[model samples]
Target: MRRFKGFVRGVDGLTRDRGGNFAVLFGAVASVLALGVGFAVNISQLYNARSSLQSVVDAAVTSTARDLTLGVIKEADAKASVQAFLDANSAAGILQANQIVLDKLTINRTAKTVQADVHADIGLYFPLFSVGDMQRVTTSTTALYSDKKIEVAMMLDITGSMAPNWRSKTDKIGDLKAAASQTVEDLLKQNRDPGDPRIRVAIVPYAEAVNTGGLADTVFVEAEGGPKVPPPIDTPLSVSVTTATDKCATERKDKDGYADYSSDGPYTLRQDNKGKTYQAKVNRDYRMKVCPTAALVPLTADMSRLLTAIDHFQAAGVTAGGIAVQWGYYMLSPSWRSAIADACLGAGPTNFDQKKVAKIAILMTDGQFNTAFARSRGASRSQDQGQVSRSNAEAICENMKRDGIEVFTIGFDLNDPSMTTTERDQAKSVLKDCSTDDSSSLKHYYEAANGAELSDAFGAITRNIENLTINR
Candidate 1:
């Protein structure tokens, strides 16, 4: 009885001791805190996994939809494709989506819609609060199926500055050819069918004037007389009356006419917008010095000929990049299909609108636009040919953008060997203004200091264009 009472007294003393109370409280709080920290870590892991799964799901569904649009995969096979994609790309265990279910795969031909609903069982790292081992993730993707085609026109500047500069020892034109050829290859690879690709490309090499080649006889209206009197819209005589042999073609200008000479219809190449009766005439000397040797190649999928055209690129003459930009716009315009003949796929889908077809222009130049056949702002600083050419380029870019054609511009070696900060800034500014103002979202303006950067610029443009056409 005495021993039992002693034990009881000891227990009572221990229980009443306040010195050990904090230890018990700390033990309880530490356990709860540990559990909370572990839960947070597990939750964060699940969130990261969910995000990765969303990306994979999006890509898989989009690819499947594209295949469906191309008739490469049927609805029955789409599930297999999606599953294979998921198995292959579970973001390296970030998304352990073990179970996949296709809730819906709707392809409405009449509506031209492709919709997909997919769900996956993503394994959980930690099952919190009696949660299951897996968490369900659902995602959907939709694409508008259309028989949209792609038309691209490369407006290359083969100016004197692009030639092999002995001082810099850089062949700018050679770099351009390589870059352009790669662009062609990339674009052609995007086509589901190579034999009859839905994509077409046109090359317009410009300097002082655009060389229409065979189209010259058919496209141009003759000079009315000598240097004194220009030709009117009527009494055409381009093929019959030219004493000069150079095929350099000039632009049409009328104060009462539109902003730029569109390649759609028969346009009269007048003298200038200075007055109504101005005579439009170019002598032989001007053509020989400024005319580019590279012949124009219209929309052709013939890869061999396309490469050959790039080979034909020879650097000569001054920069009249505006003319090239205008031609690039015209080449894609359906309104000019009558002149294009077999150049563009049937002028179907009607009008020169960019609804069904993606029209792109890649305009690259190495120097300032110092040469202009017209736009001479008489006696004022506006008469600065470089400024005039820059304005014209911006104007053409504006018009093309209005017509839904995306324009990308590049200034290559704009400031050779480094110049004053002000000069460099001006050069960059001009290129910026000429490019599509997608500065923040997608930079349409690029500047290259050397050949490698120029090639990189083309590659960047190619990727963006691919995204715009295929992934959009």
Candidate 2:
């Protein structure tokens, strides 16, 4: 400031000089410099205002495009959505939006092209070449809000907590059934071509464990492509039902503990056991009481199968969210297609990371995850069953994300006011860590206080997954 004052004083002295011709030249030079500086400052404000406004428009258009694709809004409401978004974001930039005209908002239902044109009269800080204090800035954006092929794995929690009435209004399980069924209908409807459904959904209803049911055939050579559950075990039988050393085939911990924790089966599933004991053959120390009773469905595009799986889901047993997530990845992974060919309907993909294919996992849990076991006795396996389960859930989610699977997590009514702080913190931590990333505080992780919130969360997950498209 002192330097600037000194500069001003020098210029004033020059203007006051007795020599008339020299004083005139210096005054003219000072005038030009001041005008240039003022122009630069004003121009910078204009640039900044335009840039901020452009961001607001871009975000508004993207949200509108997504809503349209999700069928929540039509072409008519899209323009309205634009106006609402602008109004909502009025304070976001330097200029206040006085008027907005949706000059061209086109949604080609047949061609699936969404183009939007927005013209806004924004109050400018400094006038540009256009002679007004307000600038009419027009911005446009285009996006193809449709997916080529989407494979989603939904892991629904059927643990004991989900069996009861929800808060007061709903039967929790009924709400889950309704939410999941509607999500299926919504996703399938995204295919503009009715005959060409590029969407496939898998359901993993988890309780004490995920009941792979028929898909276990892909895991055990002994079941000979058959079911692995009881004729009811009267006592711990000495005989091995499946060729699995541990008598557990469809469940990953077949020959070795390592294979149990992994989605990829590496052990000799059919080989005869040389060990004398079941534990020795299976290479596992303990046995889970029984897998969940609710049926498990692999990835399938058939809407009927998807809905049926949701209907068959009954609330029972404990929570093994980690196990359910591990199986969810298997449903989406291309490598498992060969083994799960029958369940996957003989269809297969080239690779998991294919550009056009989107692999996603939607995990919803009603209570704290309490039944997870390490594939091997590693650092993750804890004496505290709840801790181990939560740990395993996060670890499996990490692996799935690393393999390019987008993960969305939901904790439905997990916060019981009576619970201890540690118990409350555990569920939130697991859900947050299980999501794709934390860039969006509201996107990947959801906390639903009741059934309505739960349904809303599911709706959001469905739309976000549906929006993953290469067509754009």
Candidate 3:
């Protein structure tokens, strides 16, 4: 019996030792599993934080890219914008701790690209054997700014037909004004250059006839005594011939037969019944002196005058897109080359960067070409018509293109069935053919069927200009 008890004691001792060994093994396994779980949690948190930081960087880079292209924001501003984005999107605690670092921010002006690199150090929950730094995360992004300077002219239709809501819409003039003003603002905002005039814009409003705004003076003299005088004043002259004569007393016409005599010969003087001896002013000399030059003045930041002109736009007469386009070309022509050089050479090319400046025309119309002021009876009429003919438009576009002038065209809400398909086709063909070779330049053409769409089209063009980047 004693021997049996001793064996049982030995077996109990073995069982206790085995139980202790199992306990140690179980504890070690549990510790490893716990460590694994902690690592997984910390790694996931690090990934989440890294992703969040990368998103911030991406947003920042994109914002900077847009500003870079627009030319409005300088490099400093772009960097600031990126920083602001990061600060705005970062977690409050992380940002305060300065755990996020913008390692690199580069803007390649020549390449028209922006690049950003970011790094962050994240804290890990598992301190087990602390591996170097708790966590390190990095991200980068690149964006391209591939737009170019835009030289554009806005040719707007202001014919009497526009007086009626031809498209069965609301006030046509109001809509036009809004669209035009917005477009102008957009262009100015997008293509701003403090040091150079990268883009030149002009507004040409036309009807059966365009009011040259008293261009007769400029034209008649420039005509070099050609039969065609500057186009007749669109509206009557504000100052009548009598008023003009009254302004000059030396040569006023006289009612009395004996005009005021002078050594220069009986001065062409006149006496009124009121006994006011009015002299027929030989104001012709003075008129000649003040006669307006046959030149179109390029506009600068003359926003007030431009806006006023747009507001006063009256829909009178008929549509003459051909003449308008011709005028647009003439406005930028070197016809006054000598004068431009003389007046602006001293000032360095009249607000334009003569070195890299480009000329452009934006011709838009909703109607077919039907009239020209210079039409003659026989071949001249045909010739004048031909100048505005679709073929002629194409030729003009080609010529302008050859001269390195970019051209953009737009056709708005044209739904006239009476208008032959050929006419519409002609307009489209000319517009498409007139586009510039540059991708950004060529993207300016648009066709819209409604007011909203028209506005959007204009906005899109503006955005394109804003995104322009100088390659060099």
Q: Quick one: RMSD of model 2?
A: 10.5
The positional error of residue 78 in candidate 2, measured at the CA in angstroms, is 17
Best by TM-score: 1
Worst 10 residues of 3 by lDDT: 245-254
Model 3, global lDDT: 0.55
- What does candidate 1's lDDT look like per residue over 31-134, in tens digits? 89987987887778767766776777777777776676454676678768777876677644465445546677777666655666777676666666777676
Candidate 3: which stretches are off by over 4 Å? 1-54, 65-79, 91-99, 106-115, 123-133, 141-151, 166-170, 189-200, 208-297, 330-360, 372-388, 402-405, 437-442, 470-472
Candidate scoring better on lDDT of 1 and 3: 1
Off by over 4 Å in 1: 1-49, 65-78, 94-98, 107-116, 121-147, 194-196, 218-243, 255-260, 267-288, 342-350, 376-382, 418-426, 470-472
For each candidate, give its TM-score against the true structure: 0.77, 0.63, 0.61
Q: By descending lDDT, how would the candidates be arranged?
A: 1, 2, 3
lDDT of 1: 0.67
Candidate 2 C-alpha lDDT tens digits along 1-472? 9999999999989877757997788999998897677678767766776676677777877788777655557677877887788778855667565454567777777666677777667665555465667666777777665434778889898876677654654478887998899988887766554455577788878777666666554433233333222212232445433443322222344433332444553222232233322221112123465555666777766788889878876777777766777778777777666666655454643276536678889998877777654444555433576776676777778888888888999888877665577877887889889998855323799988887888899898876776555342
Q: What does the lDDT read for residue 358 in candidate 3? A: 51
TM-score attained by model 2: 0.63
- On the 0 to 100 scale, the lDDT of residue 13 in model 3 is 93
TM-score of 1: 0.77
